[model samples]
Target chain A: MHEMALAEELLKISDEAAASAGAEEVLRVGVGVGWLLQVERQSLAFYLEALRRDYPRLEHAVFELDEEAVRVRCRVCGEETEQAGWGFACGACGDRDVEVVAGDRLEVRDMEVRTDDV
Target chain B: MCETQGEGHQHRHLEVHRHAMEANDQVAARLRRGFAARGILVLNLISAPGSGKTALLERTLEQLRPLRVSVLVGDVETERDAERLRRCGVPVAQIVTAGTCHLEAGMVESHLAEVDQRELDVLIVENVGNLVCPSGFDLGEDLKVVLVSTTEGEDKPLKYPAIFHRAELALLTKADLAPHLDFDREELLRNIQAVHPGMKVLEVSAKTGLGLDLWLDWIRAKVGEKQSLHV
Candidate 1:
């Protein structure tokens, strides 16, 4: 459902970056998906492939996506958990007061472009 | 030919760090600024479908006397919700998202133009009935209130932690039916606290009028707090 919309956004961003750089071809685009966003990689990849037909510039671009672990800090015991679970309690003191340190964003991190000056 | 062609191209790497949700967040920030300038308090209500979001709002309009409030209702495809709220004698607008699961900030910014912002003290947005998709979006609301019905089970918050984690307050609607169903609220409270950690909970029945005063008082206090900031 919304995965298509998110995939379109990622494709648009990746293609636009390559287009603005005046690259003749795009090789790879790296993306980071946070745990909280609940975006499935399989659906996202499928949508990207299905939507990229419109963006000919990215016809063969490699969309490299990786997940970012949810990191949180416990308010009571001062311990940080790199991959927080659904329970959302402190890993140390069992306190529920935790603040998210990362894993709250989906971003296009980098891209590799090629210029064929023929 | 491969060697010659490969040599003709130059490979370059670009470091482009940009959030995919930046566009929606930008529009939300704009809406936040506009609401603040007008001294308006906006609340976005998120809940599962049929969890009584509209019913609670209907009661809100009926009970919160003298507070000028407007509603922006989001649904998949219907004008019926807006029509229902309009009967309460308040300006109501429907955001028909077609097939979209959630309402975006840009959609809200555009649809809200139809209503007069200057005349509003509070604007309640009943988000599309969804516990999942709506949590990822920000519609410039002063706070997000999540509604969970007693029938939904004790681990509703545990199952959908994202929405609960993001919400400021949780409303246990359909409270009048709790006893018959043998719903254990203590377990529900523990599950909610497990994820949200001290999030305020209110039990109310739109039909029976239980705990409506507490709900209204919370709104009144929030409205007063927002007004004092602009003053």
Candidate 2:
């Protein structure tokens, strides 16, 4: 539900960009999701499609999702490691007090718009 | 002339990279800012069904009544938790998910609009009683309390370590029934500590009022911390 709201905002941004650039149609929307967020891409896309249908300008909007893996910085050894699960321990020093430096992100990376005027 | 026009035509493609959830994060950040501005501490409670989350809140409400606290509960089916919390004489609202497994930032954002954040000191969101899914979503809360009762066995933290490890506090509820059941308190504590070492553990029997004061003190301190942050 929260992601749906975010997708709506992204769509609004895309719409504004299209209008500003004087584009007739928005072709694609590229997104980046962090591993820590663990969002359901399909569900977000489904909601986006439903929302886009309401806007004829985005009738043919395409969604592209890219995910980043979880990465943590070890507090004890100062070594950074990529984690697969919730295990935040550092592989080098076996430190459990590692801080997550990245991989909990949800952002709009890019979009594709057709600037051609019909 | 048609062949010349076709040869002269060029296609243009614009690359725009944007995050799909940026809008949701903006709203979530606004909620966090709202809570911070009002000096309110928000806690997201996650647990399995029948994990005694409401019972725990009912008991906690009684304990925190002197402090004047409020709650916002989330459930999929009924308003039973809100009804139960009303008896505590605090402002309570129930959010029914209808079919969702967890509560999201947007839901909390909408509920915040309905409730007056200035009137209450603490806002506890009892997330839709699912440990796995709720752990993945952020409701712009300050703390996450994961409750596991003795009847549920000690292996719960080990099995669902994602919620347990992410939780700032691990509450061992229903300690009064520990003796009646074969539930091992030490083993449970060990399991929780294994995942979250030095984690704040509170053993309370919301029914017996045992260790209720300790839990109340913790809540008071957290409220105080939030208040002091504003000051």
Candidate 3:
């Protein structure tokens, strides 16, 4: 799908989620994305501005992305460590068979809505 | 909450915790929904310059020609990639970022308006050839494929683990030149696996047509899955 279309979908989902939650206005939308997605923030912001023009309800809506870091869990010493850069060696055990428990996430964690109307 | 003022003037205190990229996130969410509705499986390809990303795309477009796939390529300047892809007869759009390091959701959205989304099976966004900054933004792709050419060395995965860890699939390109270079496939694979366990790794040679079938099959399956989801 095109980037604009994807942005529209995300906005729609957020709108639905916010409306269902009875939000008067969504002030903040927290999103979690893993390091692997390679998203261009400025481009996405430009698209969101376009979407906001159409959806007046989302005019004040803010999109916050919580970038999940690349984390590796050691198999030898059972130590979990975030990659200092891109190297995946465990900080404790220096194990190469370290498992990635999180980081590849793309979801709306929470939305801060004005509850004054409620 | 108590409000205080220096001059004893009553003023409403505003607690503002606004995100820097809130607007972009909203647009990305919109883009995601658009793909879901049309059943389009979008993949953003990121890699370093001279990493054979376009060469891989040329081979991919040729193989997927029968399927009628389309491409949206991003470059800092020049229609070179778009022109090269147009030779294959697929609907191609060149997103010239001018001076930008990466392609954003808004840029992709604007280019998308030029083409009919319903006609496309798979839409591949070849992002500007960069590893670091590209990994920080979302273009609303369903999957992110990070390509690392063999000549770039096996340590690339360890150096740029963010792209590797975020990638659903990693493509090790330029397999044909691996023999002439000091590139170790096992070490590269091991390094990638260390960051992304259970991640799909496919080695391909655009020059030799090696491992193209496996890559094509994987893409076909993804498109098929999207079709099923739409149904």
DockQ for all candidate structures vs. native: 0.70, 0.36, 0.09
Query: What digit string (tens of lDDT, one per residue) describes model 2 on residues B133-186?
Result: 788667888899998988998899878876887889888888899999999888
lDDT for each of the candidates?
0.89, 0.78, 0.76
Question: For residues A91-116, what per-residue lDDT tens digits would candidate 3 score against the true structure?
Answer: 88776777777564455666665534
lDDT of 2 by residue, A1-118 (tens): 4456556766787787667667667667677777666567787787788788666667887777778887889988899999876546887888788988877666666656655433
Q: Largest lDDT belongs to which candidate?
A: 1
Q: TM-score of model 3's chain A, to 2 decimals?
A: 0.76
> Over 4 Å off in model 1, which ranges?
A73-81, A87-98, B1-5
lDDT of 2: 0.78
| Ten-residue stretch with the least lDDT total in model 2 chain A | A109-118
Q: Which ten residues in a row have the lowest lDDT in candidate 3 chain A?
A: A1-10
**Native contacts retained by model 2, as a fraction?**
0.40
Off by over 4 Å in 2: A1-30, A40-64, A75-78, B1-20, B98-100, B113-116, B153-161, B179-197
Report the lDDT tens digits of candidate 1 across residue range A6-112. 88888888888888888777788999999888888899899999999999888889999899988889988899887557656667777777888778888899988
Tens-digit lDDT track for model 3 on B65-124? 567678999999999999998888789999998877778888898899766798988999
* Rank by DockQ (best first): 1, 2, 3
Interface RMSD in angstroms for candidate 2: 4.6
Worst 10 residues of 3 chain B by lDDT: B8-17
